[model samples]
Target: MARSLSKPARTSLLPWLGLAFVIILCDQLTKIAILRVFSYGESVSLTSFFNLVLVYNLGAAFSFLASAGGWQRWALTALGLGAALVIIYMLQRHGTQRLFCTALAFILGGALGNVIDRLAYGHVIDFLDFHLNAWHFPAFNLADSAITLGAILLIFDELRRVRHGSR
Candidate 1:
């Protein structure tokens, strides 16, 4: 016999999706503003350790395989899209778990945000540079920030679950 899906499960997914959409909107809007305001490679110091800059990433995190002769563009885009699908499925299955679903929602937003950039410009737009006395971290944008936060939350959630002896 086939089991039926519940209405609550369907409704529960909406809030997570809405959160993802908000992240996507904020990511894109910030990118657009940066694109309009900064020329390529331009940097403006915002603090002792922060700057607003413009850069494009053609590959995954930390520019991994970024110089792989352009094939990484579509490959990374496909990877992001695939990850989004899996995250959504997980969100549907675990929607009642607030921390887990929130983490997935953030990741989903970030993935789609980067995916949008890849499709529109063939690269991801990155800014928000942080540095210290000539040593610089890689430049990244809001979407990257969201993804990182989500990953951290996922780890924390797992730790909490383990401590509580819950699966």
Candidate 2:
């Protein structure tokens, strides 16, 4: 059976929600700066292995459905917004769980950041570029970074929970 929290032990979701807000703010701010400073496809070399390039993704990660025309744009926006709602719900329920809430907050922030871009520009702005030799990875933004980090943390949290045999 799972242990229950007493009234005094219950935690609020406000803190985690604030963290999500911060993430979203940072993500959007950077995107705004990139949009204002860089033109489409413009790249500024930051290092031998990396460049700052402005790009827009109309589809999901890796531009999964980028060529599918305009329908995918609304579809992706709806999906992201829906995911954010669900994540908020999850966070409200598990606010006392630090790792879980952190992961959800990251996802919620990233999803909101991308959704905002999709709504405002019909695409997500990406600028970070990494390349080595002949290989070049796709450009991504801080929102994507937070989401990736959150996923890794989620996996680690699950592993830890499993090892502890806690339900």
lDDT top scorer: 1
lDDT of 1 by residue, 1-167 (tens): 98886654533789999999999999999999999999999999999999999999988899998899999999888899999999998888778889989999999999999999999999999998999989999999999999999999999999999999988
RMSD of each: 3.0, 2.5
Q: What is the lDDT of residue 143 in candidate 1?
A: 96
> Across residues 80-167, which tens digit of lDDT does each residue of candidate 2 receive?
9899889888887778889988998998888898999999999999999999976889999999998998999899999999999986
In candidate 2, the residue pairs with backbone N, CA or C atoms under 3 Å apart (3 or more residues apart, or in different chains) clash, namely: none
Candidate 2's C-alpha runs over 4 A off are: 1-10
Every candidate's lDDT? 0.94, 0.90
TM per prediction:
0.93, 0.93
Worst 10 residues of 2 by lDDT: 4-13
Predict model 2's lDDT versus the native. Answer: 0.90
